[model samples]
Target: MSLKSLIQGQKPLTISIISFLLMLALVIVIGLFGGRHIIGYLEGQLVAHGIDHNQEVIAGMQPILERGLQDGAAVSVIVSNFQSFIEHAEPFGIRLFLVDRKAGRVLADSQNRAAFPYPLNQLLDSMPRQLNGAPIHDLANWDGNAWRRTASGSVELISLHDLVVPANREERWALGVSSDLSELLVLMDSLHLHLDVVLLITYGLIGLLGFLVLRWVGRRYEAGLEQQVAERTRELEQAQERLIDQARLATIGQTASVLAHEMRNPLASIKLALSGVSRSEGLADREKQRVDLVLGEVDRLEGMLSQTLDYVRPVVRDEQPVVLDDLLDKVLGLEEELLSEKKLRLVRSKCPQCPPLRMDREKMQQVLLNLLKNAQEASPDGGEIQVSLEADDKKLVLTITNQGPAPAQEVLDRACDFFFTTKARGTGLGLGLVKRVVEEHGGSVQLGSASGKVLVTIVLPTAD
Candidate 1:
């Protein structure tokens, strides 16, 4: 279609729809990018603040620590300085502890008891490395959320900004401050939530504007489209008439039901008569054999009649649990003569764990019968037909595969659609019925052709 026609034909609302989608995408992209940058900036600030606070704690304790080491002061005097440091830095949430490096034991802690065993991964920096070398500047590690460890072995946060000391070369001790990074994270989180809210509001406004624009555009275009459709109605009817030229198919579904009721009584009588003849003692062995053959053919006719009736008069289900194996057996009984005539074998490898499923038994059996009959017809004369069942976390599956020349792709595409059939005398309602019944049972049916074989798969939800 030309761009002008596409814009003006049928619905003028297309313009607003396209514009709204573009604006919605833009809003999402902006929110995502904005949230990321806001979080990054907040993290950077938190890291900077954490590093500065550690520098102060290290500076204050440096002179006292060095004097204690040089003068060989008792642990009591060293701990006094530690307590003073903590008292001064209390607002910052800084805690200090002295460790015996060789023994890995705490000597004096700001809390008036031995420090808890340090977690190696949580350790930020080694005191020996800081003191034995040039004075260290700021260093910190993010412990995620509000927990951040600094160069000095202390825990603190932005609330303790006053305890931060300027970096000094004279400092000899290392400091670890566990800063509360929550303020930064909280700020970042707030920004993200705000951005999300803004995006939602933007989408709502855009949708409202687009709806108004479309309504206005539609009001302007509706009269013109109605006039055009009225003018071209005759031409469209001619095209449809040419397209669906098969008159017989157009009436098959409707006529099948009407003819079925009339045909069933004679089919049943023929089946019953053959059954009685087959049971009677034959005058000769050859006669008996012919009688059995007649009985078999009668059974096949009866089955065909059943399929027609089922198709013509479909029954909507009040679904109930059906034992799959039992249902399959009943369907197989209906198809036994056809299977025998073709010398086709039916093999079942059903998982023992497969539970019963909720379905319309008659409809489900009809589906199975249709699928198997199709398989039987498709296979090479005397070939095998395999029916396998398995279950997953949610659904039970059944697959029927037959060896034959796979169907052409073009024919396969519309195989399940109503009135689409491949056979010369086919009613086309068989697979269509199968599709409808499976769908009504909350299941799906699939047909695939591969490796010179046709496969039909039916997936049904497991029983409650």
Candidate 2:
């Protein structure tokens, strides 16, 4: 798969784990480079310190040569004197030798053996060291040493040292020291292997710790995203419900419009005949009372038709700048008679800085009156009815709360739906009209119950 597809197919946790592993891999690579650098430096320091032993052998032999050369002793005498020193060092795996530049020979080795034509770097020189005053400019203290493998496949060290003998001598000599390093080499190999193991274990432990932390981060990230998706899903469901409600109401409005049109003319004729009969002189008192009752029922039917028609009608706005507090007080004054009949108390609160709003004045009054009427119906006898008006940057919020039995959850959910009501005689269009008007003016309605009180909240946009 392509890299993008590969990443898309993985869960957040797996992706995070892989990413952390890559980071850990990079860290391991850096550690490997650093470890090797440290080991190389350590090995150099150890070998250089070990090579100091080679110089010690040369220093010990210097004095014996100095004494013999100052006495004008033969080269054979110097060679014979090296026997005791070489024998003492034999147990330590040391090989001591001397190379005489004048004769092109190994004068004597640690084993008291001499070999002519020594094929080493120090022993052979083209220029004569005698009879020509040959310059002996080779170092007078010590030369550097190196690791070398012998013909027998054993590792050894070849350390060379320069000699300072009696002046005016017709010979130049260099000291040679060799030692077996197989045991030290084996120890160093083991140490390097141990270091590699330590690095591997340390990296494993660090990677495990990083993996756990990344897992936690991935979980939180996944949970947050899931919550957002759930919320969006709820919003979509709510929108679907709204569309369904609108479609149902549209179908109902069309049927009501037809029925109301047919019923109005027949009701008008019945009311005219009843009025004419009630004014007749021959009409009895009992007959007149029954006729009045019939007329009253007819009027009620007509009023119901008007209400239905009102709900069916679309809102036609008359935009104006209306003082919100004044309009509110006027509506409340009109409803004072109803409030008094039930002995219900109306408590009013408004923010001081709530500015004048641009909206349909008649519609605003209708919205407020419908809500007040609902509150009055829900409030217990002599219970408190609270109305509050608050404002913020972009909207005006109005809340109406009554001390009434809280409605059921289902009721609250469908309270604004057309023909949805809880009252016995309710036509269910009052709050429905209120909702339509408020929404038409760019607002929303919220119904809730809190502390056994029925609360209706309206949020109206302040923008023109």
Candidate 3:
């Protein structure tokens, strides 16, 4: 896939991986250059330490060798004495060498460490030239390194400030000591191994921490995005609900207009004519019964038309602050006889300190009465109907719960829809009208049915 799409598709996962990879690459780059610098520094330190160790061995031998040569002691004997001294004195792989340049011969050699082309790789000079060149002799001068091949065919890196011994007779002598570089090589190898371990651990920790932190940030970002999406979805659903209600009201108005102008007048005329005939004293009992049946059917049709027109009618409110508990008492009194006939029990609860709500008294009465009827109808004989009211500073809530067989989820969802009724003789517009009135008063309605109970809840604004 293209990079942008991959990043956008699973932003949290993809971005975390990318961040970790980039951090890993950065760590690797830093380790490479930093590791090189560390190793170079370590190598230089090892070499310097070896040189200092070799110089110490030379210092001890200098005084004894000069006195022995000037006192006419044999050069061979002096070389032997110093070699034994250093082997027991300084604990290192130090070798001593002496050459007779004038006799064109080796004077004394310890370990056969270096062969005749002496100082073959001489790299620096910092010692006395000779009395023959005139001027003062700088006794503490230090020379630089030299490379040589031993008779055994191995190579050694050697450093010595040339020690000029006084000439005895016609033979001139050169004396110095060299330290084998093998120890330096071994130290560098060990140092390199340690550096590798340190770099591995350092970068490994950085990669792990960087990945965890980056992943956490990405997840948090994704969570924020998800919350925003959910909020927008809720807003869209609310907008759609408003649009559907508007469309439904428009359709109902058109149908209501047709029924009022067309069928309502004819049905009224038919009912009036039938009533007049049925009242005629000349009619027999059989004729009177048939006329009354026709009139009854006419009355039913007219009732249906009136119900539809009422539901489709626009609401006009005379709003005032009304106490809900008193209204509820009167509505309950009207249904007392009906509740008694059905063997139903009424249960009421209200907040004692509840405030009055700003609403249309007539419209709210209709809403409460219709809800009470639904609760009464849904309950089995001897079952309970619970009416509850609660009030807060911002709003007032009313709830009615009826004991009944559990309803389907779809029924609860469309419970307040226009003309949606489960009753055999229902016009299906009762709850629809209730919802319209409540919404007109800037309130809301909710219906739920579950576990052998049906519940309806209404919320209205409190008085300003």
RMSD of 2: 8.3
Question: Model 2 off-target regions past 4 Å?
Answer: 1-146, 149-194, 256-318, 380-384, 392-395, 436-444, 448-453, 461-464
Model 3 lDDT, residue 124, Cα:
18
Greater-lDDT candidate between 2 and 3: 2
Candidate 2 yields a Cα-based lDDT of: 0.77
TM-score order, best first, reads 2, 3, 1
TM-score of each: 0.39, 0.65, 0.61
What is the per-residue lDDT of model 1 for residues 384-441, given as tens digits with 9 covering 90 to 100? 8898888887898899999999988887878987768888867577997787678667
Q: Highest lDDT: which candidate?
A: 2
Put down candidate 2 lDDT per residue, 277-359, tens digits, no spaces. 99999999999999999999889888878777767666666655777788889999999999999999989997777877777
> What ranges in model 1 sit over 4 Å off?
1-254, 260-306, 315-320, 333-341
When 1 and 2 are scored with TM-score, the better candidate is 2
- How many residue pairs collide in each prediction? 12, 0, 0
Please, what is the whole-model Cα lDDT of each candidate in the order they appear?
Answer: 0.65, 0.77, 0.73
**Cα RMSDs, all models:** 23.8, 8.3, 8.3
By TM-score, the best candidate is 2
Tell me the lDDT of candidate 1.
Answer: 0.65
Q: Name the lDDT value of residue 303 in candidate 3.
A: 75
